[model samples]
Target: MSNEYLYIKVDKNSMAKNKVVYLEDIAKLYSTDTDKINILKKQVVLTIKDNKPIKCVFSILKIIEIIHSIYPDVQVINLGESDFIIQYQPKKERQILKYLKIVMVSLIIFFGSAFAIMTFNEDASVEEVFKKIYELIMGSEKEGGTILEISYSIGIPIGIIVFYNHFSKVKLSNDPTPLKVQMRVYEEELDKTLIANASREDKIIDVD
Candidate 1:
């Protein structure tokens, strides 16, 4: 079927009580992306009777699944008594840009925290603290490499690496990485917000 045919709105008053519309047909109406079209094609058709969806033939959950595959932010709102509305509010994410943002934020947090720690260390500036530590370990007289100085320099970076789990992506112990935990919490909050905001149409109807 032509892409245009998918979008042709069916008049609620004219639609037969037992009319059947394929899920593929509905998916096509909303999305022109080839990948999404292929996904929709595999779904079963939806049957409408007296304008109410005939249960057992296709569940609301299934309908939600198909819709989310295309428009993650869109919602299906039941207006009751066979009346319904498709609430479309598309959310777009640029993968490359998102990753870049995460990297930038991480770097800022890492450096900012490091600077703060250094600043609070007995009122010593970061550069002065480093120089003093080096002088104490290596001795002011002998400028050559000392075991303590080398170890201290290497250990600082190593400690940071281990704490951040930069290379391994594995936690030092059973406890989750702070970044992972934060991301998970953010995702949970976002999901809760979406669920809470999903039925705006229903809320409006009730208020009226």
Candidate 2:
């Protein structure tokens, strides 16, 4: 998946006074980074950082407040951030269920046809008997009296086992869908915050 980078342009003078804010501090304020980002200069030039669309946009507003608080005549413009949303392909549960159904049905058809061939041809070879039975159940031929007897006696039970076995293994062991997406976003946000806090502390230490 593609990630987005949010850019906020502060005044040159403000930036000259400070440097750049940590990316982590911006992420902590915003939940996601899905917005237009950019940087510009008019009165003073500060710094730009990454943040989510909704939160970062709002954060910029607060930033304007902070700028105006100090430099009342400062010119601030929202250069806007860049947004990148990657399209993802995810498998649906229905596809898995449909595949299983086809397999189970195919097995039942095979077993039914075998039973029919065995009933009709008393002298038929084992393979031939199975083939004829397969054709009959597939609606290719009419069922004979012998086929009816074989089906009730054995075919039904075999069908049940085949279906049960196929269905039992339908679920996959490693499915990366819901949880993975959420976790990725969470981890990214956390990492950003940690980096920002560390940078801020470094600046304080330098000042001291």
**26-96 per-residue lDDT for model 1 (tens digits):** 33234445665466565654444453332121224455555556656544443312222222222336899
Winner by lDDT:
1
**How many backbone clashes are present in model 2?**
24
Q: What TM-score would you give candidate 1 relative to the actual structure?
A: 0.36
Q: What is the lDDT of residue 56 in candidate 2?
A: 17
| Residues forming the 10-long window of minimal summed lDDT in candidate 1 | 8-17
lDDT of each: 0.49, 0.42
TM-score of each: 0.36, 0.18
Off by over 4 Å in 2: 1-24, 27-59, 81-208
Choose the strongest candidate by TM-score.
1
> Where is model 1 more than 4 Å wrong at Cα?
1-41, 44-107, 123-152, 168-176, 199-208
lDDT of 2 by residue, 35-138 (tens): 32112123222243333211111234555555455444545445632221111122235888999999999899899878776675566564456557767677
